[model samples]
Target: MRNDFSNYFNNSSENKWYNSSYIGVSLSIPVFDGLQKRSKSRQAKLEYTRTGLILDNTKERFNVDFKNAINNYYNNKTNVERQNQNINLAEKVYVETALKYREGLASMSDLLQDEMGLSNAQASYLNALYNFKEAEINIMSLNGEIKYLINK
Candidate 1:
């Protein structure tokens, strides 16, 4: 409804015109409330599905890393054990050669050669020990079981 009271005035008094005022009744109409809910639910479900997939992948990666760490631990243990055996055999040979030399059955050169072989074997053993320790540390770290001597 629009009303202008200035129209009731005479021409001379109506020189100032009053603006028409309007009162309106309005209603907000939703075009598709049901469709909006369906779309939002679908979008949420898709996001949830994506998050699940990402979590699954993360879990799989963790499992694979754990398995790899276990494999490395076993392999390192085997290597160290083999190296220790070789070192023991080399030590036995060195001792036998030294004894043979003392008894005048083997030359000094043979003793020295055995000594060198034993030294090389000891080096290999030490290297294997270090590798084993490193692998153990890696496995501990992977399993989240590493404890620091000095905690900060």
Candidate 2:
């Protein structure tokens, strides 16, 4: 009886100790949380779409602006060239008129008219040069190379 009682006590103590050292792993899957996670995911997706759309719109606007800038640059370049030609022609005419006036072949009025034409041509050339430079700056800006152009 004593042995049996001692063994029972020993077994009970061992069982208690073993049970105290128990380790358990549990997995908890969320079933419902007021749809907060779902809402956050939806919001994130919407923000992503909005960002993409903004990027696309900006790209389109940039393309259009670049095209317009290029067109203006070319137009101004042609105008500058035309104005330069006009200046050259006007200078030649003025020279010819001055020679004729000295030889008594051209009247003072004709010589003055040629001088006025030359002056007008020079002014137009300067204006065209200013416009061409402005257009060049615009082109450089549209190409994102304004700094480079300026530095050069």
Candidate 3:
């Protein structure tokens, strides 16, 4: 509803007071401007595609990392086994060298070298064992990634 009213300030012979009434109905229909709705729709589609791509890339990376971790775990485990075998072989050689040295068939230097080789084998075994443990830890980290993905 709307209203308008007025009174004449100067006197006139026509009339001193006036009254009027009016009633009207109006309708306003909105129209799109500048293709804003289409632009917004395209933007929403692009955003959805971008978000899906990001998730795909993240999942791909996780798969690669998980596979690599498992491979490294197995490889390090094999290395540890090889190193353990080396330790055993070195021990046997050192014992033989010691027996020869006692019976005068091997020199003290030979026995000492064999002992050092055994010690080095033990050190290598320890290093390989450490690598295996590290690989295990890396494999375990995949669990955390799984939890994150699940929550997300």
Candidate 4:
């Protein structure tokens, strides 16, 4: 019994401890996953492309709208200037006609006509001013300065 106990306890192979750690590298390539990974990759790529298209479309739309707003603003500004000139001309005509009527050189009908022309010119100027302001607001909106308009 003593020899058997000594053999069991004192054997080098049985009593020795071995380190189990090891360092190694291995690569595993997928053979088949029911095409789920492929489908996911395809979906991701499609979404990326769709997003790019949407971004481009948005940019085009914004550019067109901005151009239209600018055009409208300039047209309205010109109209306002033209209307102002018309108002000034009409005022001069009315004053001259009034003086001629007082001197008995212009008929009452001529004076009335001049007054009507001045009134129409003033009304047109007011309308043009309103349209110009509206166009200016649109321009400000397109330029993303709408906040300044609100503050004003």
Candidate 5:
């Protein structure tokens, strides 16, 4: 009676066939063929190794960019400081030259030169400030710090 019941279930239309006959054979053949298995394993290892190297390169590149941005910011800051110093000196020179010209002791050309120097210094200082801000932004981007600042 048990055998009849088992046969009935095995032959029933509702019974789902897994078709696992080829599954074991397919799995065992790769192991039996040592060359194929070794080749596949080597390929997978190589792919993983390559992925690690790529990630390392990306990390190193970001580090380099961050360092460069830092250096740029410092350099721009130095430039701005120098420009400020120049503007201070130019102001004194411009004031003295203007007084001298009013007393007819200095030429108009000299006063004009002093004014131009002051203007140039002011422009350069503003440019340096802009550059410093941009460098800071770049560093933030490289460090992945700007993500929080994004609206999305």
Candidate 6:
């Protein structure tokens, strides 16, 4: 609601006030915008769902990588232990072969074969150790950058 009032003057050497008054009233009722609101609501819901799916996918991927890192770490640890055992057994065999060769009960070829076996076992053990270290690094990396940094 609104109103206004004013005075008019007649230019006849005399000023006079005339009856001039205005009054107004207004009311607004809105109509729908061709389902624009509904469309925006649907878009918002779809965007929320898409965001949720993306979050779930990222979590699943991280889980898979973490599991793989742990598996590799355990497998490498086993390999290193096995290789160490092999080296120990190879050293014993080599020492026995050397003693036998000195007593003339074993030939030079037997001693040489035992020496080569010992060397191969040592190399395999080193390789296994290296693999174990790599797996450990992978696991630490998966845990977080902070852990890897701390270790470094």
TM-score of every candidate: 0.69, 0.73, 0.75, 0.73, 0.72, 0.72
The number of clashing residue pairs in each candidate reads 0, 0, 0, 0, 0, 0
lDDT by candidate, in order shown: 0.87, 0.92, 0.90, 0.93, 0.87, 0.91
lDDT of 4 by residue, 63-103 (tens): 99989888988999999999999999999999999999999
* C-alpha lDDT of residue 19 in model 1: 94
Clashing residue pairs in candidate 5 (N, C-alpha, C atoms within 3 angstroms)? none
Which is better, 5 or 6, measured by TM-score?
5
Instruction: Return the TM-score for candidate 2, rounded to 2 decimals.
Output: 0.73
Give the per-residue lDDT digits (tens) of candidate 5, residues 1-152: 99989988888888877755543433433436758878999999999999999999998988888788899989988888888898898889999999999999999999999989889888888888888888888878877789978955
Candidate 6 clashes between residue pairs 3 or more apart in a chain or in different chains: none
What would you estimate as the lDDT of candidate 4? 0.93
Q: Model 3 over residues 13-106: C-alpha lDDT tens digits? A: 5665568889999998667578988899999999999999999999999999999999999999999999999999999999999999999999
The all-Cα superposition gives candidate 1 an RMSD in Å to the true structure of 5.8
Candidate 6: worst-modelled 10 consecutive residues by lDDT:
1-10
Candidate 6 regions off by >4 Å?
1-32, 146-152
Which pairs clash in model 4? none
TM-score of model number 4: 0.73
Residue 97 C-alpha lDDT in model 5? 96
Candidate 5, residue 139: Cα displacement in angstroms equals 1.1
- The numbered model that scores best in TM-score is 3
Candidate 3 residue pairs that clash: none
- Please provide, for model 2 over 41-148, each residue's C-alpha lDDT reduced to its tens digit, 9 standing for 90 to 100: 999999999999999999999999989988998999999999999999999999999999999999999999999999999999999999999998888787779888
Against the true structure, whose lDDT is highest?
4
**Reference-based lDDT, residue 85, model 1:** 95
